[model samples]
Target chain A: MADHAAHALEPNPTARAFCLTSAFWFAVATTAGLWAAGYLIAPDFMANIAYLQFGRLRPIHVNLVLFGFVTPGLLAAAFYYVPRLTRTELFSQRLGVLTAWLWNLTVTVGIVSLSLGFSQGREYAELVWPVDMLVVLVFALVGVNLIMTVHRRREPVLYVSIWYVFAAVVLTALTYALGNVIWRPDTGALLGIPDAILLWFYGHNIFGLLLTPLSLGVAYYVIPIVTRNPLYSHTLSLLGFWSLLVVYTHIGTHHLLQVPVPTWLKVVAIVDSIAMVIPVMAFLINIWYTARGKLGEIHADIAGKFIFTGTIWYFFVSIQGSVMALPQVQRITHFNNWTVGHAHIGVLGFAGMIALGGMYFILPKLSGKPLYSRFLADLQYWLVLIGITGFLVILTTVGLIQGNAWFNGETVYRVLPEIHLYYVLRLSAGLAILSGAYIGLYNMVRTLFFNPGVQA
Target chain B: MIQRMTPTAVILGAVAILSAVVFVVIIWPNTTVDMTPSEIFRERTAEEAAGRKLYIANGCVYCHSQSIRAFDWGHGATRIAQAGDYVQDEPILLGSARTGVDLSQEGGEHPDDWHMAHFINPRWTRPNSIMPPFEHLGMENLRLLTRYIQSLGMQAADKRMQRQAFWKQASTKAYEAGIEANVRWLSETVPQGWRDIPTPYAASDYSLARGRMIYQGFCIGCHGPVGDGMGDAQPHIYPPPLNFTILKGRGISGGLIYYQVMNGITGTAMPYFKKELESQKIWDVGNFIAAYFIDELDANGPPRGIDAAYEP
Candidate 1:
């Protein structure tokens, strides 16, 4: 642990910028989510505002969470550790900081355009063409800087964390272009049923190729260092990496299980969805074993607590996801709040938790100062934990009521009143998450720029 | 050997595997899936096409699904969605969430005026709906959106619209003729056998209580709280919601009320509640309307059928 703490005293401007970016967007994204939840409980609370309507607000909240909040949080830690693992300085801090600026610009443009009603009408791919181009461009810049840093490294063997960061940036760039159909600038889509097929393929990969790998990268780096242990097994890392890419890439069709897509495609999706256990287990066993009998150390560090809890969420979400892919289970789960709960578990519970952990892990190191307030950090952790767990139980219950009622031939309108109370509960739970986001934002900003604590 | 992985090997291997999956899952399916139009498929008019743009712009697809599945029991379940049905859709609008009902077969479900009221404020027609109102889109945009919505089922929607158009003319003519004529036309429209049947269930305290709940959810939006037909949606609807008091001393039967509420009066703003309300609910609300508004209590009178097992 002492050796791990022996790092360069120089300031990491790139990492600082990204940490600020992530904190700012997490607050903004959660606010948008809370506002959208308010609409579900009382649609006429602030009615007739076209831009703030539920339909528009939904995409804004989702895109900001994916692109603005979680991705940048993970990347902040990646910026800190990538150079350290390679035994070199970052190739270009200037380029990395510029990438961060461009990333913010892209997110700003995405939010404004979506609010002004200029979406591409595809989930996770809703950015208009110009913003989509900007997304690809910013990703390319990050890719170049990271790859160049690796090129200049003195270390001969690449660490597993390095592999994940590289794959996430490069693979995402390719998938974003393909999914958005960048070739067709006017519509950014294929026609008809094929378009649905292609959109979901890219949609699922946003998690599969991007957030999962980046979050895992942070976990692989922090868990070992925090626990003062070497990785449990290189063999498991190899298997997990390759199998995640192989299995996650094609199983996107599971989203289209009940749609009119061909049966062969659905079969492959269901089979591979169940096959996801191989990669998920391999990664978990590797991380958990490395942290074995060191639960005290993990709880002692705020970063470890967050990331360790994230791994548990990853376990629950993956198991739930595999079950949701089955035809029989999907009969009740699809097209309802059940899937919404599942998404919150995966994004907020798994990736978002890890992303926050990653940011907390690197803030002190980058600033050469301890955190501004450890108490605040722990508070944010519990708030987010309670919020997400409440969401799971409340949303899953509402979903069951809806799915069963619909299957029983009740009209959609007939079920609205029955579920009204749950939406109210969901809104109250969301308040906890919204407050957590603001607290985190304050903590991160103070740690980065205004900490009064003595330098380590 | 896997431990000896290089940066080049990792990047190249990921891209290679992604390309293979893309070909098998996306690109291959793009080429092979048949684009043939379905039997009900028809090209959209220019207005409808323009309205579709507004639909996309406003993000209406988030709440309303355009795809109808085989097992669905709600709106648009009459026809299972087909791949061929979406041949012309640029980015198919098969929404993932059903925050509102499916709109695939919603085109002719109500007249244009109903949509206007709904778009202006969904609660004006559906008090229980949680959908955000699009009144900010302006009246002109709402008309265009209405056009697009009415074109959802294509040829099938066209047929329903024709039926609506025909009945709308007749109902309007009868309404303009006189209140007495309109009441006669409404009663006459019911089958003779139905008009002869009286209300079977007594308007017990419990039954009216249940009836009141259902009314607040499904009817008060248009029928008004006191059954005066002066609900918030009254101004927008032509041949406005019927005043239930007008049926008193005019030979209104419980069966006639049941038939009208179950199968909505098409061509006007009235919608069929058959998909939403069950038999017991329909009966209870009918008796409630007859006893309270019409001041005619034929329920549990002479010629009553055998009592239900649960009834005292």
Candidate 2:
């Protein structure tokens, strides 16, 4: 831990900008989440306020967490580590900073557009065409910078993390274009079932291809460094990486199991969804083995504590995903809060936590200062963990009550009364996450621009 | 495994793998979705199209599911969703959750008047509904929304709407004729055997309480508080709600009330309670109406062998 505290260097402005962008948007994203949760507790609470309605707030929260918070937080760490691993300066810091600014602008416009009800109204692909174009452009800029750095590598062996970072940026650019249907900006869709298939392909990949890879990259890099160990096995790491790319892309249609998509496609999705265990386990075993005897060391470093916890969440979330994807299981899980619970676990508990871990891991190095306050970082971690865990429990329980009741032939309106209490609990849980976001914003701002902690 | 691979191998290989998956999973499925319209599918009217835009804008899809499956018990196992049913939809609104009821076969389930009262405040129609009121969209948008919702079942909805329209004209004539003719029109609709059968349940306090709860949830929007047929839905409905006060001294039987409540009075604002309320509830509510509004209760008259705690 003191190794990072010993560094006295000029600030890496690009990474700092990204870190700030992430920290600022995490606050915004979680506030939108709390607002959405509040609506479930009482629909009429803000019923008259069109701008603050659940419909608008849901897409805003989802987009912000995907773009504004989690992705940027992971990218901040990627920007810092990719260059260091390549044994070179970033190919272009100025371009990297430009991309960060554009990224923020894109997210801001996306949020503002969604709030004003100008969204295309697809799940995850809700950003209207203009914002969609901005997203693709930002990803392209990121691709140029990161791929260029990889091209200029001093080391011949491209580390697994480098492979992941490059894949995430490049694949996302394509996926976003194809998913949002950029050609026909009028509706941002193909026709009917095809559109659902495409939307979910992009949707699941936004997590699988983008967040999963990026978060895995951060874990691969940070775990070894913090634990003071070489990767347990590079062979296993590459296997995990390849398997994830092959298996993760087609599982998006697991979202459409209840709908009338092609049976063959659903088979592919369900089979591949179950097969995701291969890569997930491979990565987990690699990380856990790398930290075999370094448990105390991981605990001592705040970054390791977060990343390690994230890996555990990754294990739980991945297992849950594979289970939920089965057609029989989906009978009880599909089209309800179970999937919502699954999303919270996957995005917030696993990827978002890892993104925060990555940001915290690189913040000291990027700013050439120790974290502004270790205690605040620890507090934010606990708050986020408790909040997300509570959400998973409350939401899953509600989903079960709902799924089983409806399956038993009860009416939709009748079940709402039975599950009303869980909505209240979920809102209370949301308060903790909202507070965590604010704490993260303050901690990140202080670390970047006004650190009172030691520089060396 | 990747130790010997060059950067190009890694990047190109990853993109290639992703493209293959996209083609297999997404692109190919486009050819499989039958674009030809099913018999039930139809192009939306201008008013419905405008209303659909509001539906998307207001995010009504967040809660209501537009499709019903064969395996589904929801929307009362209506026609299982067919792919071609959504052929005319640009971006289909087959929402996931049944946060409200499935609106696939929802068109003529209730009259336009029921929708207005319900949209103004969902609690008016469903006491336990968590749906936020769409009153903010104003009257015009609400009508537009009703058009879109009424069009959900497409050609199927039009058929139902047509039946409603025909009945509306007939019921209006009967209503204008006089109280004597209106009750006769309403009661005569019940089949012979059903009209002879008395309600199995007594009007006990528990039964009336249950009945009142049921009425508040399903009937109050169109039937009004005192059952005078002056509900919030009266203006939008053509023939309007039935005034229970007219049934007094007309020898209105429990069977007449039960049949009307269960099957609904066609062409009027009265919706069927069969799917929403259970058998005991139908009988209890009918008994409650007979006792209070019609100033009569013949449910206790005959065939009292099995008490109606939970009527089959």
Candidate 3:
């Protein structure tokens, strides 16, 4: 396999460890996703169980997908590439392993606590105060590790990937703190409208800043290497990076467009939401340009294939998100399943796919072996692809029905029958993602420990 | 050698095609549905116009849709909104979210007083509303905004407003006429048979528990935790949250409670929950109010009806 030749070329123990940890989390998260999906389909299927309630399981699915599956997967790649790009060894393999262990422990704690109904009752900020602080600590540790490595770099040119990873870590640490409202232990709220505004601002930014930058960083790293090309425009790449920060920061008010916040704030949110096209397009143009004339290369590599697909989803989701932010468009989309659809698509489809790609790309190199089963990995990929696509279609349709019916003055009860089928459909689609997770875990476990090959 | 299109060229081509299509398909044509202009909607007073601007500014359109269609009749359908109703609008305010009730034909749905308490805090009037307070709009602007909300249905709203005005006068007279007359006036509105009909559910513990859950979910936001009609929205609703205690020993019936809940009292913020809650839920909540707050429970005793499935 090509992995033997690649392994012979570079023997990096630290990179391999990163890959192993990322793969393990990927498997764990996918399993949780499947369980959550099952709960949705038959709420009573797992009846008499406190831990399996749809409300509890839904957050578990989301948090695991975000923190356990996607974040670690991307960071594993970052661990490999930062050293490679700097032409130096990782700053501390020991710290990297510690961060990994801490991350997994936090996720486990989060799942168990949430299922036990110890939630703080905030959407996306569901983790109780202790877990929230741990997440912050993890971010700080990651930031220190990555920054220290950058400081000790042999290469002078700070790559765009490095910039993205740094920004994602730093910005998330700050935003998570504000969004969680850690200062207010009791209610995690200020009083009234201000609290709602602050909460959503944090809520939207979790996607815009944390998930978005991290995913984009992986895309930037993997796309160029697979295509055997340098980036098309460093200027445009930076343009995208900065513009994303500028535009995405203020647009959180878009979530509150229906609220009684000051009118000027709404205007700002609307304008910026529309203006999101600039940064979004800028990133797309830069990446697509970098991979110009390399369609075969992209198709040939599994990682490239997933990353490219993620970019496509990002295109759709960001556009959809911007439009949904508009007051007129939000009229139908908000307070319905449309935003939830957006959430799933943005988190799972865009960010989640890229994370998977990053993990896959690093796995063979780290394990010093070819994938235990390329067929399984490919199968998992297809399943996830099909699952998220199904999610988008089903959830968007459900959102429209709810929106239109409410607009038409039909009472809420009248619309329940219309949307129950879609909920069932979402549950089914979630199963596909869940299956993919298990396949991924099996592949990783076999490659890491059970592969019947001697290390070079 | 491989034949290939440059990524730059592909992206540019796609963008160009997309832009053209969007222009042709989405942007060129009218985006908003047309609305009609009724005499009452003809011109907003300056204060009402300012209030309209405030509504637009606060993103009120996000939660409250201003248009109603024929299909909407299921929720105690007021008149369906007409395109001509929105002819004067620049950026029509047909809102999207439903955190609050729809306001398409809101005029005269409540007296002006009902709106004031509602805008201040939705729970004060109805109880379980998630609508954020507009207290920042202050007492003066809140009133103006109330005027604007009341004018949503134009002619239809005017008719409702007229009713509210008449009721306001009568209610004031009754209140001043002392508790006996006030309670008498309240019960006099109900038909005689409705006054005596006992609740059918027997107000069992299970039934009351279900009712309490329903009440908490649907009513506590506006009806006050204690059913004093002092829910969060009370400040915004007028003649104020219906003080259920007033009905004590006044012979209020199960049918009357059911009817009021199904079809909310217009000109107030007691929105009809028929669309939001199921029949069982409404009945449960009605019983909860009867048993807990009002200390009245007519829902008891043996089955009085001839069962269709059972042989006599």
**Model 3, range B1-312, lDDT digits (tens) per residue?**
001222233224333433443333223322322233445556666776767766654446545666554445655665665546655553345443443466877677667776776666554554434445555557888887888887777666777788877767776677568778866876676677666666666676777898987787667766778987667666544455677876788877776788678777554455666766767777778899998888877774333454234222
Candidate DockQ values, in order, are: 0.75, 0.60, 0.06
Q: Top DockQ: which candidate number? A: 1
Number of backbone collisions per candidate: 0, 0, 53
- Angstrom error of the Cα, residue B15, model 3: value is 34
Global fold similarity of model 2 (TM-score) = 0.95
lDDT of all the models against the reference?
0.91, 0.85, 0.70
* TM-score of chain B taken alone, candidate 3: 0.77
In terms of TM-score, how similar is model 3 to the real structure?
A: 0.64
Local accuracy of candidate 2 as per-residue lDDT tens digits, A1-456:
113334466456788888899999999899888888877778877686777787788888999999999999999999988887877778899999999999999999998988888877678888989999999999999999988988898877778888898889999999999989999999888777777788888888999899999999999989998988888988889889999999999799888887878898899999999999999999999999999999999999888998999999999999999999987888888767887888998899999999999999888887788888899999999999999999899999999988887777777776787888998999888899999999989998888779887767
Instruction: Using TM-score as the measure, name the better of candidate 1 and candidate 3.
Output: 1
TM-scores of the candidates are: 0.99, 0.95, 0.64
Flag regions of model 2 displaced more than 4 Å. A1-7, B73-75, B177-180, B224-238, B242-247, B290-295, B303-312
Please identify model 1 stretches exceeding 4 Å from their true place: A6-10, B73-76
Quick one: ranking by TM-score, best first? Answer: 1, 2, 3
Better of 1 and 2 by TM-score: 1
Positional deviation of residue A54's Cα in model 1 after best superposition, in angstroms: 0.7
TM-score, first chain, each model: 0.99, 0.98, 0.94
Winner on DockQ between 2 and 3 is: 2
lDDT string, candidate 3, A300-328, tens digits:
78889889999999999999988888777
